[model samples]
Target: MSASISVIIPIYNGEQDLPGLIETLRSQTYPASCVEYLLVDNNSRDRTAEMLIAASEEMATQGITLRPLTEANIQSSYAARNTGIRAANSEILVFTDADCRPQPDWLTLLIEPFAKENIGLVAGEVVALPSQNLLEKYADCKDVLSQKHTINHPFCAYGQTANLAVRRQAFEQVGLFRPYLTTGGDADMCWRILQGTDWEIEFVPRAIVRHRHRATLEELRSQWKRYGCSNRYLHELHGVDLQRELKGKESLRRLARWVLKELPINTLKVATGKGSAVELLQTPLDLFSFNARTIGQREAKLPEKAKEIDRL
Candidate 1:
């Protein structure tokens, strides 16, 4: 028999994005009778709650169970996910963000690896949605949200929750995501599962989710800053070594080189219309991301207590 699945999404003021996700879910090729949608509202001040209620009513008749859950007290997406995880009624718990649109076969292919008893988690691919905006295009050029990036992490292979699926048993063994963690919970959970159990992580590239990239420069900076914060938390909890950005002299030398050489070359390329300006934007955008993360690491508050995995 096919495993039952629960799609858990964390929504925070997602009034604009939820409807599109609902349509995608409605069109899923997976058997609707075997799947449920748990849309967790993270105490949104917007119309997220109202939208979810309406979605629930709309999806009910289509044989897909849509539930509106609230994680009102905790202001973390991980916490909201935990609420959905606990409330989920299936053997497989699939996670995605509100700003993603899963392709029709996403759920089907994502859980396909579960047929292997040793597979603990399935990480689907995340591609930026089609965009004409320069910043969003830059994210696409870098494949910023690709599962391959995290799946090949130096410390350990993990998957972003943007397109991850975990078996209930594996989750049970490793416990739930750290409710207090605003970031890095996904990586932490994967590491714990790999170290604590015999199960393995699998990548499903065909299971794709079209994600909305950060549209503005500020949003882009904030994204990388949060990532830097995650890096710090992971280092504190698991002792993952800091990357080269913290090696003061090496970092300074690299910055000096960029300022002296690459910057002017790229600027000239854009000015002369030599090549794709979007391609040239990669280096500077990367630098911008790097600095944002570095600042985030420095500004991050270390957890006062040792990392403890939260469980039901």
Candidate 2:
């Protein structure tokens, strides 16, 4: 049978967590014969390579293949994924991280939306690990991970790389991912596709997976810094005037954030939303802070970020 999907998992030092991801896929409700698991290992110093070798041995017995592609100079997660896409054999390619475990029907649900010809990309949600720590709690509070992809938007394309599937033609047409970006690469892809094309993107809530989060406050700060840097890069790369647009995008969300923290809400005469009013109000503060953290060293942040990538 022709492969229905190529499950591309890119790794750096995924270690023991990688094994569970493969196991979860094996237990999927989707026929195991429908996909090939392609694991891309981008130069790990840890036992990631060794562990995958062991896992592949067991997979061999079950008539399944866990192929590995190792390379030098592991740049970033986005680069690893691009490698996987290049190596993929299936026309329908799915990308996920090794740290994430799919639900039994994750693959099946993700692919079902593609029954329509114009549906070029499919984006699913990322469920976070529930934890008691402040950082994890912060992420849980800020990122409404439980929110489903609203199908009403025909242009629905915001996707996290952890759980996304795209047709080979659309991916090729959209020009794949910008290798220059370390983060926000997935967002970049979505933006490029929507720039103007005869493409349709669908959101599939059933295509879900659990994502791992930073365990400590320091890691959380670093994550934010990287995020800020990505925001800066994306704004510039896309020719977006973030200074002008951010305040128009962030206020109410920030106020709601303050509300969640039990802090004081700044404004009164609150208006209900169908638009970006609240975000517009809050974005300036975020923009200033983002710029402060990003500093004049936005260029320097990339190499600095390159150093922090010990992807386990």
Candidate 3:
């Protein structure tokens, strides 16, 4: 049976990359009649809304349906996604980021797994775009977006929203993404779909999207810090043990060692052209990410600390 698909993308300050994403979507192998494109603008101060509006008009002339929706009340991407889900007209709700560029057959392959009866979600692969610098190269070789690794460990399984699809019924059954969360919402959704029902999530490696990694150290640190904040929220919601997972002291120790010893050694090796550039770059980045995540987790817990002080 052929399935109709609604591709939903949540955008915020993505005007520069939106055109390329739209162009790639236009080139998809899936039939235009069976696919719908929904772009949700999350109150961008930039021209993302204008760009999407213009693209929609142009796409309509080509017999493609492109709808622009806005979720201005909330700033979270999950909230925007929920808006898209409610407005979607198809049985399969596919999600990808505005910064990601899908291959021509990405949609075709992503939806193919839905042909099976028990499959409720499809997690597609996300590959880093061609790296033009050391920071990008470090991200390219990292295990950041490996859905297969996550799926194999169901307890921690999470599909990156950048390349994921969910059946409409499964979403209805499991419920919408938590509106309060700005990050880790994809992981939260995957956990609920698996734990709340009998539905299975299949990983489709061939359904690929090229993602742009952070090109600078500051951007990379900011990204990890966001993840850290999300981690704290997830722990509170799920009653997961933060002390067990975070091991704050251990992280601090590692950060110290990396900053004091490994960083200098790697830097010297790189300077001498004896060390791998990716390794040299990745070590400090990883250390910074760890410390930043720890800090975020600590920050998220402050509200609880305030409550405790009030009780005292």
CA RMSD per model (angstroms): 2.1, 7.7, 5.3
Candidate scoring better on TM-score of 2 and 3: 3
User: Model 2, range 61-179, lDDT digits (tens) per residue?
Assistant: 88776777764555567667777788887899898888888888888888988888888888877888767654455556556344353233233346777888888887777666765
TM-score of each: 0.93, 0.75, 0.87
Ranking by lDDT: 1, 3, 2
Local distance difference test scores for all models: 0.89, 0.67, 0.81
Model 2 poorest 10 in a row by lDDT: 303-312
Q: Score candidate 2 by lDDT.
A: 0.67
Best by TM-score: 1
Q: Clashing pairs in model 1?
A: none
- In order of TM-score, best first, we have 1, 3, 2
Stretch of 10 with least lDDT, candidate 1? 301-310
Report residue 96 deviation for candidate 1 (angstroms). 0.5
Q: How far is candidate 2 from the true structure (C-alpha RMSD, Å)?
A: 7.7
User: Model 3: clashing residue pairs?
Assistant: none
Q: How many clashes does each candidate structure show, in the order listed?
A: 0, 13, 0
- Candidate 1 per-residue lDDT, tens place, 191-282, comes to 99998899899999999999989999999999988988888899988999865564557567767777888778877888888856675666
